[model samples]
Target: MKIYRIANLAILSLVLSIAFATAACAADNTVPGWDPAVLRDASTIKVMTTEPDAGEHWSNLWVVVIDGQPYVRLGDRSYVRIQRNTTKPYVKLKVADQEFDKVKVEEMPDMKDKVAAAMADKYWMDVLIRHESHPMVARLVPEAAPPETPSH
Candidate 1:
C-alpha cells in the first residue's frame, strides 16, 4: 500500500514538471519596437504565411493583445493555408503602417479562451461570430534580427 502511494506521488511530480517546462517554453514577451497597442487599435491585420502564388494569398485577421502578447485566430481559409504552408510557422505581418517581414507564428491552443475574450471585447461585431467554433489560437512572436557586420 505504501509503495503504491509513493509511485502515485512520483507520477504527480513528473506531470507537474512537464507542465511547468511546457509553460516556460511558451513564455510571452513582446519585441522592442513592435507595440501591442498598434494591433489593439487596428481592426484587422494582414498576415502572409505562405509564399505568394496563384492559389495561396494573404489573410486579413483580427488581432488582440493581452498582457503585451499578440494573438490571432485565423479564418477557415487562412487556417487551412497556414497548416499546409511549406514555410510552416514563419509569417509576415502588416499592422497599420508597421510591417514585419518574418514574425514567428506560435499556435497557442491554451490561450483560446483568453484570446477569445479579448477579441470579443475589442470587436463590436464579435457577437455575430461568437458562436463559431474555437479554432487553434495563435500567438505572434517577432524573430530577432540578424547582427549586421561593422563597416571597415
Candidate 2:
C-alpha cells in the first residue's frame, strides 16, 4: 500500500508539473500590444527573436514612437538577431516590466527618416544611428488578442 501510494504521488507530481509548464509556455507565446500611452513615454524596450539554434534570443534596444507606433532601428552590421526577424517575424517585447509576446515584425524602409528623427528626439546618441549609411528598420505591431469565450 505504501509503495502504491508513493508511485501514484510521483505520477501526480509529474502531471502537475507538465500542466504548469504548458500554461507558462502558452502565456509566453502571445502578448497584447502595449498601450499607446506607455509607448509614448518609454525610452527602451527589450526584443526577443526566434533563434533557430537557441530557440529565443533577447536584446535591449532603443525605442521610438512614430504616429503612435513603436519602431527599432539596427545598423547594417549590428547583431544579426534582428535580421533573423525577416524570416520569422514573430517576436517578443518588454517595456519595463510589461511583456508583450508574439508581436508581428515588419520592415519599414519608407519610415526610416521618420523613425530616425524620432530616435534622435528620444535619445541624443541615436543621432549617429540616424546617420548610418544603411540602417535596418522594423516596426513592432501587437497581435490581436484572443476573443473571450462564454463561461458556462
Tens digits of per-residue lDDT for model 2 on 1-152? Answer: 99999999999999999999999888552445457568668777777876667666677777777876788786663337766554467677788778876676778999988987788788988656556655568888888657789999
Write down the lDDT that model 2 would get.
Answer: 0.74
TM-scores of all predicted structures: 0.71, 0.65
Predictions in order: lDDT:
0.81, 0.74
In model 2, the runs with Cα more than 4 Å from the true position are 1-33, 77-79, 85-87, 145-152
- What is the Cα-based lDDT of residue 118 in candidate 1? 90
Worst 10 residues of 1 by lDDT: 49-58
TM-score of predicted structure 1: 0.71
Q: List the residue pairs that clash in candidate 2.
A: none
**Per-residue alpha-carbon lDDT of candidate 1 for residues 1-152, written as tens digits (9 for 90 to 100):** 99999999999999999999989877744344688888878899998766445444678888999987789987677787787776678877899988887788899988988988998999988897777765668998887666679999
Residue 139 displacement (Å), model 2: 1.4
For each of the candidates, the C-alpha root-mean-square deviation to the true structure, in angstroms, is: 8.7, 16.7
lDDT of 2 at 146: 78
Alpha-carbon runs more than 4 Å astray in model 1:
1-32, 51-56, 149-152
